[model samples]
Target: MDYNLMREFADSWGLLAMALFFVGCVAFALRPGGRRQADEAARIPLKDD
Candidate 1:
C-alpha cells in the first residue's frame, strides 16, 4: 500500500467520519429521556443494596 494514497484517504474520509461520529454522539446525548437516564445513573454509586 502506498503511504501517500492512504494519507489522502485519511485526510479526507477519515476526517468526515470522525465529524459525523461526534455529531451523532452529541445528538444521542441530547435526545428525549436522556436527562432521566443520566439522573438515574448519577445515583447508582450512592445507593446501598
Candidate 2:
C-alpha cells in the first residue's frame, strides 16, 4: 500500500473540507428543524408545472 500517498491525501485541505461538509450534512439531517422543513417541503405542491 502507498502509505505516503494515503497520508498526503487524508491530510490535504480538500479532504478536510469534504469531511467537514459530510459532518455538517449529517448534523443537519439529524436536526428537528431540518427534518420538519424537509417534511413540509415534500408535502408542498408546486403552483405551476
Candidate 3:
C-alpha cells in the first residue's frame, strides 16, 4: 500500500479545506438562529390541513 502518497494527498489542501467546511457547517447548525430556521422550515412541509 502507498501510505506515503495517501498522506501527502491528504496533507496538500483537500483535507484541510474539507475540515474547514465541515467545521463551518457544524458551527452554523449549532447556532440558535440556525436551529430556529431549521425548525420553521421543517414545519412548512408538514400537513397542517
Model 2, residue 12: distance off in Å is 1.2
TM of each candidate vs. truth: 0.94, 0.57, 0.64
- lDDT per residue as tens, model 3, 1-49: 5999888988987788999999999998998788789988899979587
lDDT of 1 by residue, 3-37 (tens): 99999999999999999999999999999999999
**Poorest lDDT segment (10 consecutive residues) of candidate 3:** 40-49
Candidate with the greatest TM-score versus the true structure: 1
Q: In terms of TM-score, how similar is model 1 to the real structure?
A: 0.94
Q: Candidate 2: lDDT of 39?
A: 78
Error of 2 at 23 (Å): 0.7
TM-score of candidate 2 relative to the true fold: 0.57
lDDT of 2 by residue, 1-49 (tens): 6998878877897688899999999998998788789977887795354
- Report lDDT (CA) for all predictions: 0.99, 0.84, 0.87
Error of 3 at 2 (Å): 16
> Which residue pairs clash within candidate 2?
none
- lDDT value, residue 3 of candidate 2: 92
Q: Report the C-alpha displacement of residue 44, candidate 3, in angstroms.
A: 1.1
